[model samples]
Target: MADRSPEVAEDVDVVVVGAGILGIYQLYRAREAGFTVRLLEQGNGVGGTWYWNRYPGCRFDSESYTYGYLFSEELWRDWEWSEEFAGQPETERYLNHVTDRFDLRRHIRFGSKVVAAVWDEESAGWTLNTEDGHIVRARHFVSTTGVLSVPQFPDVPGREDFAGEAYHTGLWPKEPVDFRGKRVAVIGTGSSGVQIAPAIADEVATLTVYQRTPSWATPLNNKPISAERQAELKAEFASIKETLEASNVGFLHEAHDRKTFEDTPEEREAFYEKIWRSPGFAKMTTNYTDMMLDDEANAEFCAFLEKKIRSLVDDEETADKLIPRNHAYGGLRPPFVTGYFEMFNKPHVELVSLREEPITRVTETGVETAKGLREYDIIVWATGFDFGTGALRRMGVTGTDGLELTEKWADGPITWIGVMASGFPNLFFPGGPHGAAGNNPRYGGTQVDFVTELLVHARDHGKRRIEVPRHAEEAWMTMIENFRQYSRFEEHGQYYGGNTAGKAKAFLLNPGGKPKMMEAIGEAVSSGYQGFLS
Candidate 1:
């Protein structure tokens, strides 16, 4: 066992294991609630996702006004965003500014990656050890490790054989990559691939994009937010906050509230055209309520999008390859993109469908496929992350009876409202599994509020140990199973569950809408904190 001396181990009321936007807000709230809070971050700075994912053309799909903290009116009014969809650097700047404005840096220990956290039943607290051999003992442990923090590289043969410079979009280096006159090969067609391919198409002498699955992308009508519009939004910040809280997807877009089959072909085409012209993820919302639920309705939207794709691309075959046929529209997280499809029109750009000609291996020159080996100057892996529970699983946490969190979640993650596990006492997870599904920043604040309420309750009752009972956890899982019955997530292989690695499908996010999920959480709290034991 490591040293348990008071001098070596600092004790606090709460230890937050991340310094992202969620962790920042959580630390602030815990301090306000009279708890001595210490924050540990692996990165050199705050902005967990924004700090690492500095890929070219990386930006928020949600609107700027709806994607920030609603807790402080002063902060909201003071921080002005330049664009409707803020880029990676601007988002990072905003997060750093928030940390400075609130003076949160002093509480944060940079480069302190937590390696292990063990629950001490005798002391009724958690003992955490950092990678640098530093130890911390806290009454409460909170994990705000955002879902997309851990990047997953493609498990292709001979990945290390590539002689040229290789980079993953999730873990891009801080220095600017000069793609000028370089032959670039980008793999995967997720949001990052869609964003990166177009952004570098002009810069690179030759750009080759390898696609396994085609993403259904609507045009991001991204433009500068005028000074006048910024002022108006700042003035009505309260109303904006209210709208965000009440909405389903944690944005202000109002659904059309009609069925897709109700409208005529002309009317439907006109509505889709209007949505296509607008910015943000409004296309998913400003349509029939059953667009994601009903197959026939979803097909109509898919056909409409395919037609739009066909119109954008010069060649019919390329456009056909881009159209997603397997999954329904809005089935996976809808990627709002700009110039993704139009990039194919450039003479220097080339699209290789991996589904037709699967990648065989990575050679010293470049990627080798069934057709032949293609040489490149650089390779960009836009492959996604080990999302949902991967970030937390890597922390090496153990609870009662030496129950390892990794072992507990080996099959899949199970929790009561994605906040706490059955055996993990005094530990909270904000924005983890089974939580609200929506704009991450918006739901992040809601999660903070939920955990804070529980903390406050525990303090009021003089409770040092808190956890969900086994029965409660099982019951919650059952609730999640029932809710997912209506969702089409299982029909398609996506990351919604831990399905990327051929794992048994499980509902990772709460299938119920944000409003209903929040209501259920609130109701549970009002009912004497049902499901949780103190």
Candidate 2:
């Protein structure tokens, strides 16, 4: 399905830059709007993030049913998810199914990684140069290169010179990695580390997890969907679509209608215990509404989680290490797992807290800490990506009058609707900063739909270009910055583009979530796509 054209098309009305969920849909919408489109994908197949991050135990933190596209009810009902939290293999298969079902593969040119995109104002089109020596010219360019596309290695000495086989979870190899009977060391305890640690725990001779900070985690309680449950999902497709569209969090979990202290202490304990067993994001969505906003309420929940972790792990000291003391329960994005803490009880699995003894370097065989050197057959770098703007900045995109995208966004990105930035005519970057970040597909889909509509408007008005006016971009930036005070992630460095050194500390996610995004988009549409000059 992934084919590289020997004689590439000289021109197209729209050129989509990825083969992910957004890219696939963008192609469909563009073709429907009477535009010739070509989708460029770097990977050999569909599923951008899911296809690449195929490391052990990788799966959906969002519910399996909720994560799928809502473009068609027929598509939704036909495909079935095996579990509440679908694993990587199943998720990849689902995306492939969607691609083929919609007959989108023919339009996609896989292995076509866009290296540089230059805008020509005279022609009012973009000249895209791919990694494998192909030039695609198009009137419009839409970048669906997702937020987590770029893989970043830690700044540890001797990391590259390591003699052992090392792999970052984000860019895992296609062929199976051998771990059986081998000593494995996984660095970083974020979402990927939490999942892969327990998965390879029994396989490896010994598993050592290096932690910089302990993330507050809840149980996934993942389970197979019964035939009855599947039928119910199909039957509830309409309601599911409605709730997902209207939801701020992009999930269908029933929200609690009361504050944390509305119920007595014992009642609150019972409520916490009930949601503690619920699957995936239900822990956050269905919890007391005040859990995120109020400090006292979050403390109560964190206390309950601490006691629960203590109960699961046999070693008291090991259990204490797992509990996060600095950040509150919902301060940073919490990881949901099946046996992240329970794996520590396994005799072969050990916890290496970087705080007590920091890692000085990565040796030829393994990681070296202040305490001593620990050798391993493999070093799994579960370290995350350069987050929001990393992939786009690396693409060498130049806009009006030789303005590089990285240079324009050097301070921070300024987008009218989290998609179109000023001085970048006919170039829209979705699935990155300013677009909704947390629950990607649904929220990102919102911006995706807007871009399509704007394309239609441009075509109808006999316009060859579209750019957010400077005034509109300024107003949008103000709104995005104003909403920053409402976010729970002020201390969470990664969300603010603060994790990677030298990267601008800008809020990469929409602080207002879907509701506010929808509101501003509604105004733009009503005003005949206001402030869009062509």
Candidate 3:
């Protein structure tokens, strides 16, 4: 739906900038609170990340059963997902279903990307500028721009000179991509590459994967949703939602209960095997109490994952090359997929680990590395995002007193709850630095729910603005630094740490302990949204 009013553009009670999960939910809550709302979306339609990332094998790492709106019991019962990890098209459909169900699309301005947002101190409102030079005003603004929305192009030499077609999984074409018989080269073995490689291998003439770091990937065991299972989960929707919020990452699963070293060697081995067989990212680590702490214990778990990779790949040489050796086992983000290892069996598929033979440059028709020039018909830079702070930086956002957010967060992002920044007033960010995301594996929907709660509170209350107190922001910043100080990633060795040669400084996850972060949020909600208020 497009807002095509003939009347002059004017102010609204609240401006929700995005039509993604977070932005949509914010509009729902704001409307419920009796506030007139307007939504601004950059794309032609909604579904934010789902709207953009339509590449082959792009799917949610979280289970489909729990990766949706929990605020409405009706919505939960009515909707159904067809797989453990829903693909992009299905995700888009789900968003459409929600939009139609709630009648939200009516207020959204499709294809309208917000170019600039300036706070007006005198008017006590915000002057927001869209790309087409349309200006609108709003008393309150909520930015639900996702953390991973921006795509990052690697700064490899001759990258722009490539004669072949180049595409990023994050910014895939809406139309169908034909890899019918073309040779394809995929660089970066992060989540996107891990998921797409096997699927593309089945179609492309020859597939070559340039691996900079071998990600720890587990089987999704993805399957269609069953009627009986859907019925069973729907019955327990409230309980599931509550349980998800209690855990880190806001999802439920079986994790190792005992300490890493509490069990005997054989017992630990048995536990590790059990989780490996389980579905999705939940199986990456058994509900282990100490895998996150205790260096020795974490090392033991890493060794287990390494062994699994070795056993899966038939070629010992390839197996060794694929296994991650240096960083802490759980340091880098985990990848969930199907048939990732089997792709190596294909005669035409080759794995070029950047560690051994560093890429020198991109040639006119191929990639030139220390080993040799590997030519391909198409190249996919699945190199991932400039995460957490990139979008805010790239857009040139200036906060109070003309303080630049990019310059302020030069080393890393500093936010109270990955939601609100100190100097930025009346601007609420749903997915900000140090935002409260847990390891429960079902964190996305919870993120939407939690952020909406704050937005609704701000709208409902008569307060004209809410800005994070400077002291509060500073305290939270200290906490983030302290957590990083104790974690394995304090030092930059590879991508997991702060440094990678060309890897942009992007740390999406909040480093603070989930439990403590959630506690702070609870305190806020109880105290009239504690941290920020007029």
TM-scores for the candidates? 0.96, 0.97, 0.92
Query: What is the C-alpha lDDT profile of model 1 across 326-436, one tens digit per residue?
Result: 677766767888999999999888899988999999999999999999999899999887778878998989999999998888777898777888889998988888886
Q: Hey, what RMSD does candidate 3 come out at?
A: 2.8
Q: What is the lDDT for 383 in model 1?
A: 83
Residue-wise C-alpha lDDT for candidate 2, range 1-534, written one tens digit per residue: 434554554588899998877888888888888898889899999899898999999999999988889999999889999999999999999999988898888888888888999999999999998887778899999999888888888788889888989999999898999999999999988888899999989899999999988988999999999999999999999999999888888898888999999999999999999989998888988999999889999899999999999999999888878999778876667889988888999999999999898889987888899899999999999989898788888888999999999889988777776888888899987787888845788887888888888899988899887887788778778888898887777445678776687777787888877777788788788998766755
Of 2 and 3, the candidate ahead on lDDT is: 2
When sorted by lDDT, best at the front, the candidate numbers are 2, 1, 3
Q: Candidate 3: minimum summed lDDT over ten consecutive residues — where?
A: 490-499
Each candidate's root-mean-square deviation in Å? Answer: 2.5, 1.5, 2.8
- Model 3, 287-324: lDDT tens digits are 47777677888788788888888877888888888887
For model 1, what is the error of residue 368's alpha carbon versus the real structure, in angstroms, after optimal superposition? Answer: 0.4
- Stretches > 4 Å off in candidate 1: 1-7, 490-492, 497-499
Error of 1 at 83 (Å): 0.7
- Against the true structure, whose TM-score is highest? 2
